[model samples]
Target: MGETPWDKGYASPPLGEFLTKWGVTGRVLVPGCGTGHDVRLLAGKGADVVGMDIAQSAIFRAEAFPAVSRECYVLSDFLDLAASYRATFDWVVEHTCLCALDPSERSAYVDSVCAALKPKASFLAIFFREVSDYSGTGPPHPISREEIDLLFGPHFECVQSFIPTQTYPSRPVGSEEVCWMRML
Candidate 1:
């Protein structure tokens, strides 16, 4: 795939706001972190962070993140994490990653994230809402709130959700919103 249109230049606003309130400066993981923008932002706030993506080029771009430690960025499929890293993070923050996957894969996504968290650790996931198209062919395959609730409710607690006054500058105007949940 050529440049993912989802790779807009900065950390997502609603997510960024959530992180700020949630606190940085601890073990954190950003899975499917395209271009590592949010990882950079998290690290800037003193978070000890890892940014993982399936693309080597994306990993290369992420490795340049000033705040991520030298070994922090890894090129790996989120579904298959090594044993040593299991339950290793205080938080796992998902941007557009889960939404980008086929809906059938959402449970595995939830499992992988759960396995990666420390006991009682939390996860923060952002979903895009209000799409007009729904044959579900998109890499961005949009998700409804009910689907989100069902998939994550068993393992996590809904924390907060809100619509944004702003979105990634490159994305279509008013095309997305953000919701965050914490691990139970």
Candidate 2:
């Protein structure tokens, strides 16, 4: 691949906004973490962070970056996560993974997250809720608020959700939604 299109180069602003209010604790798992921007951010917040992606190239790129003490990058598929990862994290932080997946795979994604996070652990995500292609074809199939609730409801309870004030400048207005949920 010439370049990772999803590589934001910096952590999503909403994540930083969320962290300002919430305490980072225990272990954090960032699935589909391309280039580890969010992993480094969480690690800086003093959590043991793991950035996991299915692509080895992505992992290699992530590893090349300077570590923030407790952060590590791993090559792992979120859908069929390794057994060792089950119940291993206190928090699961998501960025582009949900929209990148086919909508049909969402339930499996939720299942994997539920399995990865420990009981009562938090799951925070900054979801892409706007799409240019209404015809629907992409790694980025945008998600609606209702669908997000329906998809994750069985395993998590929503703490709060809001339109983030901090967003990428290139994105359209209201292109994202920040959701904070706790595992049931």
- For candidate 2, write residues 4-115 as lDDT tens digits: 6667689998888888888767899999998889999999989999999998988998999988889999888999989999999999999998888899999999999999
Evaluate residue 19 in candidate 2 and report its C-alpha lDDT on the 0 to 100 scale. Answer: 84
Shift in Å, residue 16, candidate 2: 1.1
lDDT (Cα, tens digit) per residue for candidate 1, span 75-140: 889988878679999888888888778888889998999999988887876677656565667777
lDDT of 2 at 12: 90
- Candidate 2 has its poorest 10 consecutive residues by lDDT at 1-10
Give the winner by TM-score.
2
Task: Count steric clashes of candidate 2.
Answer: 0
